[model samples]
Target: MRTLPIFIILLGIITINSCSKDPETDSDDQTKMFTDNDVLEEIRNNTLFFYQGDTATLSAAGNSPHGTFKLLFNQTALDALGADGKLAAGDTFPTGSLVVKDVIRNGNTSFYAAMWKQPSAENANEDWLWYEAFLDGSLLVSIDAKGNGCIGCHRANTNRDFVNSFDLH
Candidate 1:
């Protein structure tokens, strides 16, 4: 009576379970994702400064069609950035200087000039986050700073080793 129907349902469940794939193990069949090692190498060899105290004098093209930027790091500011951008108590950060040869353009005319210290801080990951952009030599717009939340939001994953710098070098 009722026992026969219960047995049939249990049998059907066992059959379905045996036929289904386990999702966790199936990820191995997917292609591996990768970051470009060249970019990391460029950053290491050509970056103006590095955490390990290496230095580079950037070429005009290294700065690119927009301009160049630099960093000056100190422990106070690095601590202020916390594991995230938040500051703890008694935190004081050194202000670093930034010099840019901004490119501005008006129609066929292009010119360049130096801009300095519009914003300044001593933390590389916090203040001088890197980006790539371009313009003529007259009207300079920071394509990088235009989107502040883009980095900060992505950096929400602090557990994944801060991730301010990419891997694959």
Candidate 2:
């Protein structure tokens, strides 16, 4: 009986120590670290590269001679674009998220994306789009689910005066 209490205390200490390190269970969460380059790289590596055509495809070449990119549709993109009538699209149109700020929200993460060299048939400028989470200034994991909706929305902007063109240059 005398030694039982000490054993219990030791077990409790070990359990507490193990629990303290668990990221999922710990109350004090360590903020994820992400930089603009990290965000850009993740977007590039994870996002499904698409090309322009009457129908968007999985390949990186097609009507989109300059190449195309896709992003999710969420509040971030709407708010950013809504707030600013224009956003930079590298050197051309079709890709507005590069230097632009189009974003969408997916759970706790935010998605931001853009592309360059807008396909001529679609417009004079490239098309860029994104879905990002506006979670203050904290870092979060953003998955690039650049699905049909992305292409469909950009398709609507096929006209010369489509809202896709922010004239940010």
Candidate 3:
């Protein structure tokens, strides 16, 4: 009788182990459901912003509406852009590349705009996903589906790989 209980416990352990998902694999899956809170937590924990040179200032009628912004690139994206000292006319950022624009209003960081480069196969039409979020506590806003708004403006800058801050670098 004791042997039977031991066997059942062993079987249960094996089943649980087999059903569990790999954390590393799950983290790398871009399609996974990442909530705004989750992304904000990651950005805060990872210290995603690093570059601190010049602040790109905007006028009242501009996109940021009288805000000063700074562009920050992840190491992977920085390597790709730095390889040529400047991003050429048709250079596409590799998958996992992340660009963040920190927007400042009244000497305080109010919000952020970000772009995440997805695998080309994921979105054949537009591989880059756009996001906006308030720094205080608002949820992330995904604007990729509204291509005509954000994507349309970026499309005009094909030379800089659909980025407006390339000149700032």
Candidate 4:
């Protein structure tokens, strides 16, 4: 089936990108995937929630390289969360959703970990474009490069669409 090849390609991308630290460059072709401006645009115009709006609680990392941080979801992601402010068990995020995690260090964002859901026949499952980078667009983990540990660490069942932020928090 077509799905099988897509899965293999995805696995390879994850494996390769995780092991490689390709700094995001202007010359890098991210047009078909995503760009830094897309992240900024989401932040500027969409809903942002931290600790699900419980400001007193800032979640600490569990086996995450990112220390203290907040999770922000764009309109698509927020809409997906629905009234409960949480995804029901077994429910998956819709296509075109974007969620960004701000890894705060010393009161400022040291880096970002983000997920973007793409259209696929799998109901948006396993279709996320994983990305992580520093403030100046230095890619820590790109959509491509070399073993993407990002997928392994960020399993979908965690009230996430490859989002590890909410479930553990």
Model 1 residue 138 CA deviation in Å: 24
**Model 3: number of backbone collisions:** 0
Per-residue C-alpha lDDT of model 2 across residues 145-169, encoded as one tens digit per residue: 3223345545544442233433211
Where model 3 places Cα greater than 4 Å from the true spot, the runs are 1-34, 47-66, 83-85, 120-125, 143-148
Between candidates 3 and 4, the lDDT winner: 4
Model 3 alpha-carbon miss at residue 123, Å: 7.9
Candidate 3 yields a Cα-based lDDT of 0.61
The lDDT of model 2 is: 0.36
Name the better of 1 and 4 by TM-score: 4
Per-residue lDDT value at 144 in model 2: 31
TM-score between candidate 1 and the true structure: 0.21
Models, CA RMSD each? 16.0, 16.6, 7.0, 14.7
Per-residue alpha-carbon lDDT of candidate 3 for residues 42-150, written as tens digits (9 for 90 to 100)? 4465545345433455433334332576667776677677544456667778876677777878866778777766543233236665667898647456543433357
Error of 1 at 57 (Å): 4.6
The models' CA-based lDDT, in order, is 0.33, 0.36, 0.61, 0.65
TM-score of each: 0.21, 0.28, 0.61, 0.64
Top model by TM-score, which number?
A: 4
TM-score of 3: 0.61
Error of 2 at 80 (Å): 3.7
Worst lDDT run of 10 residues, candidate 4, spans: 117-126
Error of 3 at 43 (Å): 2.9
